[model samples]
Target: MNRLALLAAASALVLPVALSAQSPADPIFSPAAVRAHVEFLADDLLAGRDTGSEGHEIAARYVASQFDGLGLKPAGDAGANGVSWFQRIGFQKTEFGQTPATLTVSGAGEAKRFTHAGDVLVGLNAAEPHLDVTAPLVFVGYGLENKRLGLDDYAGLDVKGKIVVTLRGYPKGLPSEEGAHLSATKGKIAEAHGAIGMLSFGTLQSMKARPWARMVQMADEPDFTWVSPEGVPFEAAPGLRASAALNDSAAQALFAGAPTTIAAIRKTADKAGGKPKGFALKTSVTIRADSVSQRVTSPNVVAILPGSDPKLKDEYVVLSAHLDHIGVSPAKAGDPADKDRINNGALDNGAGIATMLEVARAMAQSPDKPRRSIIFLASTGEEKGLLGADYYARHPSVPIKQIVGNVDLDMPLLLYPFTDVIAFGANHSTLGPIVAKAVAPMGVKLSPDPMPQETIFVRSDHYMFVKQGVPAVFLATGYANGGEKAWGDFLGGAYHHPGDDMNQKIDWDAGARFAQANYRITRAMADGDTPPLWFAQDFFGDLFAPDAPKAPK
Candidate 1:
């Protein structure tokens, strides 16, 4: 009962009515509101709030109770128990068996075998629990294919009945977001080309940027995927039954007798404007996969602010934030006596949920509501490949077509006094101008993406909505006014670490302004005469909503 009151007062207080000249123009948003929520959510009591765990359930219920207090309508599933604020989603967890999957490269004098957890990191096949497949190897520069872009990494090579060896990432010169989208379609393109297996390795540049040691640590974690209504996990290419990501030693051994050595490819990948052509390797590879699968479930807390206007009430705007983080870690061999193993994700997502709650409260308290209905979604399993958002997009409580736009709040680094902001995917749709106009009054500048090489356009929960033909924008504090160093320090040190707790020097002032900017953007989209639309010639717009009307950006 005491915790419930804490949840209710999470947005009540932290600072005075106003802080400085750079503070939000509106007094409704307060640093106190953002601080209280972060403090409670990131507290050690939640135990990191992993998906499907009791900690995360408490987090979901807290959001649901907050929605109830705001007088928002339940926007989830209908059952014999009546309507509820949770859209539950089922999931499947596939753990690789004790076999310790092996990948063997043959035809280079003698066959060489690489074992999982040592030379290779391989996930379960899911479709065929125990898989032993062998096929010829083909080197496809980046394994990318696009007709409009005049790029065909598999130009004249026939990859049918073969395993494709691809260099990680796309060409360096293409548009960042569009390039990212295409880079992510490697599996889809491989399946379309009739490939039966895949092997990928990081470029030297990428390996240097993000050390292979980090990848090794991450490989220890299990993988998760959402289950379909058909009771199967979603596999982009079910036919590509065997796949693995290789490290330097394994990659070098696999390219023993190839036309172009892996070292040459690595050098080419390091240089800008460098591209390699496709060629069949003088080798064949075999992969072994054995997996154990289990069923699990989680919920997406949903609530709706019904529009006041009858004509535009059907059109909806979604404001979403994830509520899950990596759970407590197992003790390492050489750990400190008093180690903090829990991964309390304060800025990673607790800040996002807090900001969204404040926005919902502001709209509910206002006498004048937007013309279009607003859906506040507290998603689950986002840290596990954006599963919750993907599920909600696939099985929306309301008609999917009625969802006009999405504003996703993920990790907003509020550790510095931010003067500008970066809104990913904004340029691809009309939502860009709306956000710019919305934040201009608050002395906040909308800056362009600085780390384009990271390819963050499709990393967060909003990408799911974009894939479902909805125009979406993901907002975060920009790399300005000490933000660059703050982001760098966070990503390098505390991200996903036990150190991401409430003890960090977080700037609540910046959080209040960020919340206000996002509120204005969402409010403007909901109240506008016309709903947000995709750009006339954008890649994502053409790919997802070919028949829908597109406005010039």
Candidate 2:
């Protein structure tokens, strides 16, 4: 390709035409290699690559080997037994110690025990394996305690050593990031109030977005938390001993003899500035929690490509993809999909990891090395609430301050010929234009997040980096050119199911294109003069990176 060419036009205008240059991914990508990586990782022998399982360990080593073969430097923890490519993470898995964990509510000479899941769903007690608690129930509205927002549902309530009932989500209207942060911190709030237990029921708004049946379907799944170095799980919330999610029926049962009915509470919550007050309920719930926990370790396969420029070499850019998936579908009869037990996350993340590996290969081998260092983090435990990325962000091998940006690749829908890609959180930072530039050469436009209501900005691994004040974006194919239906179908059917295997119609060329686009983005972020920065006064930037640099508005 010519860097510059001149053509004489009919109107006597001499125009300089710039020929199409090779994409960063095209020169280094192999469709066959991409397919082969997914094949090996998604194989039945890997058993769905569950975190802390032997299969995920094998998957981590496989990624490390790929890095080693690509000549990338080891960038993990230095350990005596394990190699430096492995950042061994500690995890605790909890399963039901005794099934049919019962909840009995009694008050005012009336007792009701909801045994079926239709009324309530009992969660595994990951903090304490064996637990039994009978505490007075108090309705604390939404259980929020933010004084700055002038919202304090626990102001006049005495919930010390008692069970506090709350709504599932924050109020209907709040800033997206703040509301998301508040919604995720309900347990800590309960613990801070000296509450012994908590019960959360869905609100009308929340249930409309996500149905109750979906929650019950996943009630039997195990719970996991990352254990700290001291062997205690972070934020185990010791004071909050037992918890349960109630359906409408169970919520109504709790207010059986109380001052206000659950129906009235729901109705009040629906109106603007109309909220239920914190009040002592006439009921007491006896919760029996019997669960078992075990400590296990998994690794984040970390590797780096050294930078070329001396000054910028100290700065770093990260590329991340989760290597773990939900191990296997629980055995269920009469379903042919369940007959194949293994939940081969070929797209859920097998494809994402494969893309990262190829991008790492390209970056490491490219003659035009990037100015800033590039770290390829094949993370684990993403299926379990982005634990691995959180650990990496909080305890990075590299200096956290030097990590300029992160690009997360997770579950790129590869079933269609996508003309545009959505980079979640891109608009919040300088990465927005950078992303547009990177994918433009591939004839792919950068699209806005189609489903903002999903709050997908904080759902994936990159959001962990964002919380650490690093500018980050989660890149994936957008809903265009048959992508809408494809995404809907895959998420509805094969997502985390056994059907996401190599048997699907995976467009390898699309995979190659996606990998190439990411490579260009990583390259641009690494070699560009200015490090990525939060857009001026962006919500996430102001929330997480207030002291960090910001790009001009």
Candidate 3:
């Protein structure tokens, strides 16, 4: 049967009255229901639900309609109707011009010239339309400076008025989120140390996970950021004059006369936990780049289900999922035999949003109402640097303090029958115990992140909430019952590809189970008297919410 027919059949079997009377313990997550939602959202007609596109607007309307049917009050920006189901977010899109970026290395040997998008990938500085820099090169290992962890790649080196070259990533054993947080500050760190330009290359392990060709392909895409009403783009790194990423060949050229090869440095850093030594290169580097910018607006679908307890109704627990995907790839042309070019992100995020929809349905229909309000947010522009979530965090519809916690669902690969789950950010808050309690009866085990090197924790929508001091967790199917191989295969073959369509195999039962687990976790958070708290000395809590109350000693 088709997805719509299967949904109709399932709905016919369950009477409306029975559904309304169903308890939280009863199985309300129907595989057929979930499949119907996924198939529709992931359909080719949606054009991969690209942010700000007509298809994305259609998906947003669909989500708003579902919220309306569930009796969820519109909690978004106010409109002519007094309330809207969408929190409109404005963005600044910056696309680098076709003017080929130029990079030249000179020293004791002949200077080599590298073309843009060929041997090096140069990033445009939106703050400046043009950039030109010439400085001596200095290797700064991972370019990380963390006083808390006593890691300083520039401890004994002086990079003043020079270009800093660094590899990507932090120490191997640090929490994945912490590593990500530190790595994100590399540019700022370089700027602080008087560096004028920055050159970065992926480590061998990192390059193996995501190839250089993929990175180069993404370099041409327009970079996006939520902008102010005055049309000012949010400046993430203020002082950097020039920045570029080098492929293996370009990196070798940069290190032509150096004593150690890039391979040797990568192997040493891998074995010693990202502690490679820093040294002044015998070569000097120069760079030039150009770019153009435009402004656009997108919507973040928002709704709320009020709590039964009058006193606690003001507090909220957020359930979030990104509705945006990579969208249609211009690089892939469709053939006459099979003209399918849309990404159709069935697993990357169609599964996540569908799961959120089911969870919302269950919460709305349950006889026992939660003590705290539940907010459903289908965010946009997550595929573009978490723009929607970051915007919401900065300009929340409600008071930021009233948001007690967040549970984010993103890309729960359900190709196999998963018996375990990996909950990123679970270790730093009370939400961890709540998840453990909620999933015990379901015969599902909560496991640590299987691929921490990828820094999965800070790569999703939930990290925005964490940055705003709200405790949060991102859930994913763990490596159990052959799930590891399934996940690896998907990441290698279909991730961000047009092949992640409805034609791919999926275990609907597993998807339903995953949704049910999330529903229970959300229910527990809403029904509990106490709100989730950050553990004592937690790095995120200390950094983001220093004055907030800590967990019990």
Candidate 4:
């Protein structure tokens, strides 16, 4: 009766095959752990967790301590022996001091003082004792000074301490043969001309993609603090620099008042096929700036689970998630959502951090460790143009060559039940197929990137590794599975807004499953014999071609 009864009970419980486990001994990802991590990281107490703030520091310490508790080896700074896990990455912070800036223009016998915050704007250049400029204004076409192209806007004349005014954007289309020869390039070319300040026309419209522009705007207001990239501590010649975009009407008025406008100057320069006699304007801007500079330190949390194989243990697999967010948003618009204020960044990255932790925990419980090392990096300042990852890639604890694959987990909140995963850089690299093979048995379909026009492949933290010739891939929810409303609801409401708070509306259970799938993929790469690679069609494919091979299942 005992054997018969036990057999009968087993048969009854396992009748349906789809519900049974693949292997009883296999390690399964723990959803409870992932939820716990996410809840804490996305908590209101974190205060939206903006980088370079006290809130950001608190999050960094928590992550570092977690790495320490994981019993993972240090893989940060490098010494004579090998490498350490903790590296000191510091940046010099700049503050626009309380010095008021004033702009004065004496045209038509009118001398008026312009306010810096409202009427005028200025930034720092070289750190000199002072920036006194009375040089004549020369209208340089985009200010390109490429020696290779035989185009030097300042070839005939001097612009060392002068003010240069330039047009914005690449012209409507390809330039004429003569125009191309002059090498009128991007905006950065204008800054290299040794001009005290540049008045940029029609360029501010493109500032939507620039963090510096946005930060400057916020700094003008009294309620919020602006955080910029850490410069090299102090400029060798820090001076007052002011730039502005003159509207069409404004440009017309300036041209009419000056000896020559940008149009007439360009016409003359083009006719000579070189720098023509320059025209000067009777305009001077008096910029009195108050600014401060200081050194700031931040850390990238690194924890590693060493591999078991004698041959491949030295190689590495990186699982990364940015621990930092945009932090608190200033309350404007007088709406309740704006008052919500905290850009808690639940989906932007708290989800990725929790997923990485869950994956690490699951692998730690496995019967066998991965063949190659698994490194978990909670990088900082991702919203600040991937600064932390960029810094780490250049100063990697392990040899960049030993890194086979990098899986960056970002924005995994809205998972679909039946749809394929939106795998980025799939076509750009061979890792796409490897990912597909790993998820196939789980009955999950893989989908090509649906929003190619967005050029999302170049965005996110993974791109940093990719830039260093490593194969990196990231997955996010796709709009193909859900209706327009569902897609819009998630992105439109919480993408980066204050409404991205921790509410029960998030499908945590589904998110946990997605995290588990990523864990399995990471495990496969970590233990496999072959490394992932960029596809032949990808722009970076040649960089890793020598080591590229079919990833082992």
List the global CA lDDT of all models. 0.86, 0.83, 0.85, 0.61
Off by over 4 Å in 1: 1-16, 19-27, 269-273
Best-fitting candidate, measured by TM-score? 1
Prediction-by-prediction clash tally? 2, 1, 0, 15
Top lDDT: which candidate number? 1
lDDT tens per residue, model 4, 1-553: 0131232123113222111123354455544555556666666777767766676666666566556655677677667976555555675445555666444554535555555545345543324324334444656655665443454555565566766766543222323322322222333454465666666444332233232344345444221112233434322223325454444434443454676565665444444343434445556544455555555666677778899999998899999988888877766665676356778777778778877876776676677888999888888767766777777776677888888789888877543443457677766665787778777666667787765434566667787788788888887655555624555577656788766656736666566667657866897788666777665544355544445553322
Candidate 4 weakest ten by summed lDDT = 11-20
Q: 1-553 in candidate 3: lDDT tens per residue?
A: 1353344234225432222223456556777777777877787777888888887887888889888888989988997779999998888888887687889888848888888888898877777777777889999999998788878899889999889999977766666789889888899899999998899888876687678887877768888888865667776666778888998877888888898889889888777465788898999888987888887888999999999999999999999999989888874444564666789898889899989988999888888888999999999999999889988888787899999999999999989988888889888888888888878778888888888778887889999999999999998888999999999899889999988988888998888888888888898899898889998899888888888887952
Q: Estimate each model's TM-score.
A: 0.95, 0.91, 0.91, 0.69
Q: List RMSD in Å for every model shown.
A: 2.3, 7.9, 3.2, 9.6
**Model 1's lDDT to the true fold?**
0.86
Where does candidate 3 stray beyond 4 Å?
A: 1-24, 256-264, 331-337
Model 1 lDDT tens row, 1-553? 1263465465654444564443343446788888888777787778898988888887888889889998999988898988899998888877888888888888888888988888788757767788899899999999998888878899899999999999877766777787788877898899999998888898876676666677778765667888877776877777787888889888887788777878788778767757787898888888987888788888999999999889999999999999999879989899997998999899889999999988998888877888899999999999989999999999897999999999999999989989998988888999999899888888889998888777677999999999999999899999989989999999989999888888888898888888888888988999999899999998999999998899976
Please give the range of 10 consecutive residues that has the lowest summed lDDT in model 3. 12-21
Tell me which residue pairs clash in candidate 1: 13-32, 14-32
- Better by lDDT, candidate 3 or 1: 1
> Which prediction has more favorable TM-score, 2 or 3?
3
lDDT (0-100) at residue 71 of candidate 2? 90
Q: How close is candidate 1 to the true structure, as a TM-score?
A: 0.95
Can you give the lDDT of residue 544 in candidate 4? 40
